[model samples]
Target chain A: MKWESVSDFFAMGGYGLYVWGSYLVAVLCVIGEIIAIRIRRRTLYKHLGLRKRSILRGEK
Target chain B: MTINWFKYASPASFYFLAGRMIPYFSIAAIIFLIVGLYIAFFSAPTDFQQGEAYRIIFIHVPAAWMSMFLYVVMAFWAGIGLAFNTRLSSMVASAIAPTGAMFTFLALWTGAWWGKPMWGTWWVWDARLTSELILFFLYIGFMSLQAAIDDPRRADKAGAIIALVGVVNIPIIYFSVQWWNTLHQGASVSLIQSPKMATAMLSGMLIMALAVWMYSIVMILIRARLIILERERHTAWVSELKEGVLE
Candidate 1:
């Protein structure tokens, strides 16, 4: 609402690069953390499943 | 009816509780983030002095606050675990390190980005910046210390000592601006004084802070649940959980 056009919003009154740079990295960090956790959860589930199968087979 | 608070102290109960709560927290985090970003870019008026560069404050301030706050929380849990020998408490302490480290990195990164245009330099060897960098190292130290030990109990105890000792740095990082004439500006929002910014700007920062807070809770709980699964894999309950999942 403050900007008159799309270019004005993106230009950010000449501080655009710094503002966007900060936000871009912040977003990437969040995404990276989420993906890392998901991978961890999947691996954990796989390990647990294998352990359960081994237990059913009377193996330690 | 008395609700037994300690009932949830066991990882088993806490894991399920966290699982149920994650959805709600995730929703809250999303909503707050959207609203906060809208207010930050659209609603809040541009700063007259700093122009648009000041917009970085929303992320930088919140990340810096969370970085320090999470370290304290991590240390508190670690200390409790050390005192009481609580497994879940130690697991929580370990779970918080990565997220704390992430925010610390964000704070420094965003600080550098904001600094480039405002301060005419990327970084300065100032007290606040140096202390925050040390906090990042502390997080890495805690995580690596735990990772190096084969035994979980030993790792937790060792990590707890470091975490508790590292608590001294937090207050230093917080008061650095006031204590030293640092390049970084002093806190705009303080407990004893009115905020120095416009209402919309203040609200946006606060809302972003809430969004980050909720997001932290979700990440910590998720990681804690994973730690529980890892450590408790030998237990019958974990085996039962596996069965429940398979079905």
Candidate 2:
């Protein structure tokens, strides 16, 4: 609220680049982790499903 | 009744326990972060020297602390895995590495931000900063080494060794200010003495530190659960777990 406008908020008293850059990197890292975990889960589930199906067919 | 501490060390047991713990840690992290940010922004007075720029310390110091703390934890778990050949240990270590690296990067980034306003530069090669950069590289090296190996057991062992070797750098990073002529200020709130800052500032920093700790625990628990599911996919317990969750 101290920042008068959107532009002022981004400016951060001339520390716009450094402050925003740090925050951006941190947020992106968290986002990356979430994406990586979801992908890993999907791959693991598919692999397990395939293996289970193969074993079932072999048993048949 | 005695609790079986070692039981939870088992991958399966840890999976369930970490699941339960995650929500608690997540809630605590959120509460503490909200409170800490409020205090940091509103209650703590601005510094005469650094003006509003000093507010960055609230996040920066906590991030730096967590960066170091998580690495030590990762190495500890890695050592356990190597000694006992336990799946859970390796999983814990792997879970912590990425988060540790993130915090390390945050520390450096915030430090650079703070530096630009006070020191008139975006970057510095001070002793503390240099050692912290090495810490970041160490995290990347550990993750890469683990990913490169085919055998999970062999990968854990190799990662453990690298982590142990990297442990030597932690002490160097902590003591760099005392050991060398560094632009970074020496510790103001060391364990040996009362903090030099005002009570409000110290309280805000401590609250932020607690929030960071909670956040790390929650993140690590989530990661470790994912590791458990991946590693234990062939086990009957995992099949049961999937069935129960799907239901």
Highest TM-score among the candidates is held by which one? 1
Q: Any residue pairs clashing in model 1, and if so which?
A: none
lDDT of each: 0.92, 0.83
Q: Tell me how each candidate scores on DockQ against the true complex.
A: 0.38, 0.19
Minimum summed lDDT over a 10-residue window in model 1 chain B is located at B238-247
DockQ-based CAPRI category assigned to the predicted complex of candidate 1 = acceptable
TM-score of each: 0.95, 0.89
Candidate 1 residue-wise lDDT, B1-247, digit = tens: 9999899999888877887788899999999999999999999999989988899999999999999999999999999999999999999999999999999999999999999999999899999999999999999999999999999999999999999999999999999999999999999799999988999999999999999999999999889988998999999887765665423
lDDT of 2 by residue, B1-247 (tens): 9987799877877776776677789999999999998887668876767666777888889999999999999999999999988889999999999889989999998898888878888778888999999999999999999999988889999999999999999999999999999889898579988788989899999999999899889878877877787778778877765555322
Off by over 4 Å in 1: A50-60, B245-247
Stretches > 4 Å off in candidate 2? A1-17, A50-60, B245-247
Tell me the tens digit of each residue's lDDT in model 2 across A1-60: 455787876675666676666667767776787787678656766866644422211111
